[model samples]
Target: MKNWKRRESFLPVAVLLLLVSLIASACGSGANTNTAGGAEAANGSPSAAAGSSTSGADGKKEEKTEKTKVIWWHSMGGELGKAADQLVADFNASQDGIEVEAVYQGTYDESLNKMKASMDSKSGPSLIQVYEIGSRFMIDSGAITPVQDFIDQEGYDVSQLEENIASYYTFDGKQYSMPFNTSNPILYYNKDLFKAAGLDPDKAPATYGEVKQAAQTLAAKGTPASFAIYGWFMEQFFANQGAEYVNNGNGRSAPADASLVNGDAGIQTLEWWKEMVDSKAAINLGRKTDDTKKAFLAGQISMTLDSTASLRGIVDGAAGKFEVGTAFLPKPDGAEGGVVVGGASLWILNNKPEAEQKAAWEFIKFLAQPETQAKWHISTGYFPITKQAYDEQIVKENLDKYPQFQTAIDQLHASKPSQATQGAVMGVFPEARQIVEGAIEEVLGGSKPVKQALDAAAEAITGKISNYNKTVNVK
Candidate 1:
């Protein structure tokens, strides 16, 4: 009985250790990934030897290697997923050395959560797509080999990658992930509503104040409420106002100590927004972006703010309803800060074999190539992350057919980058955004004053930051 009891108690502890070991083996370093399979993956960069081993040591032509199957977990669905599937097929056909299989994970947040379990089992995919908001979490998890690591090892020149997109994904002066399917927030207005409201259809609102005026005019014209009450919009407004999202230079330098969001920028934006709702100039559409978008597509709303990636859907939805015009997101006080990149990126997982890593990197590079990006942008309406993609014939034809498409690209190029625009980097950002949205709801519902609601949210977020920092041991 004593021996049995001891074994039972020790079982859980042993299992926990095994799990930890598996996770560490999977993530700690891909530098040493050849303990099994009898085949040595390369040395140093793991894939280094395999990469250059197209020939043997005798200077004789080497035979073809076995196909390395690379698993790619992504959150894309619908049309985007179809495009991804086509690309994967194209990539597989292009090379006999690698076979990439694209698997659809849930949403971005769900992918992150599910990835943790797979990492613990040392069965994580070779590549995972992570959203921009998950940047800090992915870094702190240490489950990734930074893109710069592969770049330096392979001497890859990333000069073709757009700087505006790179400015967001880079951490500590090094690129962390390869930017993919990038987008920026822009204003989409109905020209028919504008004409009915006696406003110029050719010009767009350039500031928050103008948006309100346009909303008031549209509201008077029996147009649906203008704009969404989404948390992402709040973040954009703060950045455009040149307000710091958090301390420590929005966590670009060091971990953020506290949130600076409840100050002037937050108060002014939220207060005016509440006034808009109360005056019926705008309606509080709540948290879901799709609801706001649906209202606009149904012609219930005149104008809205959404990611440029949504342009294709909106265009399709408005086929015969009304003309859709897009412009840069209206700035608060017309400040100088630029906007951050939205959308996800390709992160190469560590603890994978060198051959697999090299294979995954090949696919990532192919995805970023100008021709591929041009095709992607034309199909999905997502801004091509590469500058050269804009020069492609397909992209140029798309731009000519839809002039509003160029608005987002021009806006990205014209604005100057700053700490505010680069966006806040925090492991707790997803939670913080939830809290902020809740606060906005309370203020709009008249349960709290704008400043008071924002202050309370900020204080709560500071506690979350401390806890998250503790969990990640980031100090």
Candidate 2:
């Protein structure tokens, strides 16, 4: 196991604790007065209220017709988004006192940025979809409410939800968000290319060594073996092979005190990547490709590792022109270890009125229902977060019709959560990933050795962590 250290300069955690303590103290009496500029009320628009109206038995107005509104910002689009929209609609219709409004907020990063800016300005949607990478930032911001507390306050059954998904959003003993669209990377291959390379299309490579051999064979046959050099993908490869990236997977308080990207496992992983690059079997698609997906769909590359979320787009874009097969990411020498979870979760903002908070919780609960989760998973290629959904007869039946939907679920089942593989919660991780990606590019471009590139990248990340820590107390 990698050494774990809480990031120094505990201001971020301190501030969070202080704010939470203050909120608890101020609201200790359980008073539900509206404060913080009535942002909650502003978000709970009149339309939401109107949409909640219902008729009495005698066709007269119901005596008690109060309704609460929940504004949600999400990045899911297309079929998956529509499925989510329908879930919200159904939830709203099922209850007369809560109306949940779902809005598309562009990509994951865009949604997170919007939420951050809104938090500083003291106004934003009551609920927003945050990628798992944004967990640390959300926790440090003190702008979001912990879902566990909310669940307790509302008397909801936390046990009803899948524990694994719940654990992903938990810090210490409390959960901050509810897992929504969870997924992991899988090996997507072009079957036609496999046949051309004389490999069994049905039998994808089961181990790292086999993958390399296949790549070599494909290259000898004049076909590009693989596409793109994704740092995160490589990180998962190392993790699945029982290697650590940062100490304790960047889960602790301070990252600088626990840097391990230059450790033995890290060095070995980088060397393996270098060997692949040197073999000329894999092509280094520039980070800013006009469209990497386009290249894959067009048969420019035979195999690639990416999020299962890309399934629908690739299948739709290909339009039944090519046979697509999905498999788990291969491990080195048939090594056994679980893959890490990717994708995002939905977080509820703090400072909302009691009524609105209740409504938000209601909507979140609805989203966690097995039917909704299964529908979302089937439509989006993201694994259903709840175990019931995964085992649902409906989902099982649909697997025959849409085989791609099962790949992500299989990968998730094969995954075991670890401090290293569960994922990194460090601040500025998106920026750090870009820096690491750039370093990977340099190594692939023959400008530097893998060890040197990684060392420089680690230094840069450590500097960023130090600078960020200075600005925000982490304790």
Candidate 3:
């Protein structure tokens, strides 16, 4: 084991160490979008030339006699946060002219709010990590200096990045933000439960129909719940069915005025979820995804849908509980698309000192290094964003031990990269998802009809998007 020396951290050890108990909630890859559609791409300006650098506040390079300090604000907690801290230490030690300080700023939502506050106070971090859905908000805010500028200037060949992973972070043929922790959802089930239900332990369900059938079998055998129903998994289902979450290709080309999820895919999915809950085959664990995960770990539920990052936690949690297994997310009978990539990316803010921007760029490049990416993948359960990181020995060993991790790798490989898979690129996606979850609750609770619930969500989301675009002067 590589015993990395402890480094500096803004939070006390007790609070940060508490994250170790949090498990790999993998909420990072959870529903960050409306219908599992978030972590949108931002290619920025495709016309940007090589060796370009969106420079200092004055757009001019200035001299600095002292080492430039670059601040990186992030929301990763627990073990992932520790790994991030180690990464910063490694980079700081490897270079002399630049010092990178990583600040753990609570959750993703909190970090984003803090980042905005910092901007208001003229004290924003040079490098900020935002969740996938924050893509549009960050871009529309106009405070980010696309890292493409630094990549072009440094002539850094980003071809080594995993194409599928990069697809979600790229926009307008331009790379806006650098994708960091990327992952997709997968089906997690108990092998023992599968066998008990007379189902194939090795061949997990691949379609909603199959899942329903398996759930029936499991339930008949006294399995309380088969899977957890939430907006994220529904988002995966929509993508699988080649359904769009919003108009204008998930708001990539122009501002989205309405939601497309109110169509066939949406109705079919929610109806199926209602049947599951009604039949007692799937548990209505409410919106707290962690509770559903606990049910699965305790054998109260037979299967669950979650991000690949949560594999380690489930494995650890299921050690004395049951034999856990993984597979691609269950789709509709004949879906044509794939799941969107969830997880966060790194964005460099504009208008900072030229030296600070350059320093921040340097650290971003360092983090993208194959060695660094490998450490990140192994230490945390996030997928490696670079093609080369898979070749690392440590990564290989990690996967070999936890074969469930391979399910996400295969599923991502099989995914057809499209607008549906890239997720919604609207500025208000963060809020849009809340509306989606609420619709799920209303419809599933039997208080509102599926169509009515979804239509209401669509109306609310459209208003939010329209107002957001107007707020940012989109028109």
Candidate 3 stretches with Cα past 4 Å from truth are: 1-65, 226-229
Q: Pick the lDDT winner.
A: 1
lDDT for predicted candidate 3 compared with the true structure: 0.75
By TM-score rank, best first, the candidates go 1, 3, 2
lDDT of 1 by residue, 22-135 (tens): 223222211111001122212111111343436678889765655787888887666677777778877887877778888777566556667776775677789998877778
The total number of steric clashes, by the backbone 3 Å criterion, in model 2 comes to: 15
TM-score for model 1?
0.86
RMSD of each: 10.2, 8.3, 11.5
List lDDT for all candidates, in order.
0.75, 0.66, 0.75
Off by over 4 Å in 1: 1-64
Candidates' TM-scores? 0.86, 0.83, 0.86
Which candidate do you rate higher for lDDT, 2 or 3? 3
In the predicted model 3, the residue pairs found to clash are 35-235, 39-132, 39-133, 43-171, 43-174, 51-152, 51-153
TM-score of 2: 0.83
lDDT, residue 270, model 3? 87
**Candidate 2, after superposition: displacement of residue 432 in Å?**
0.8
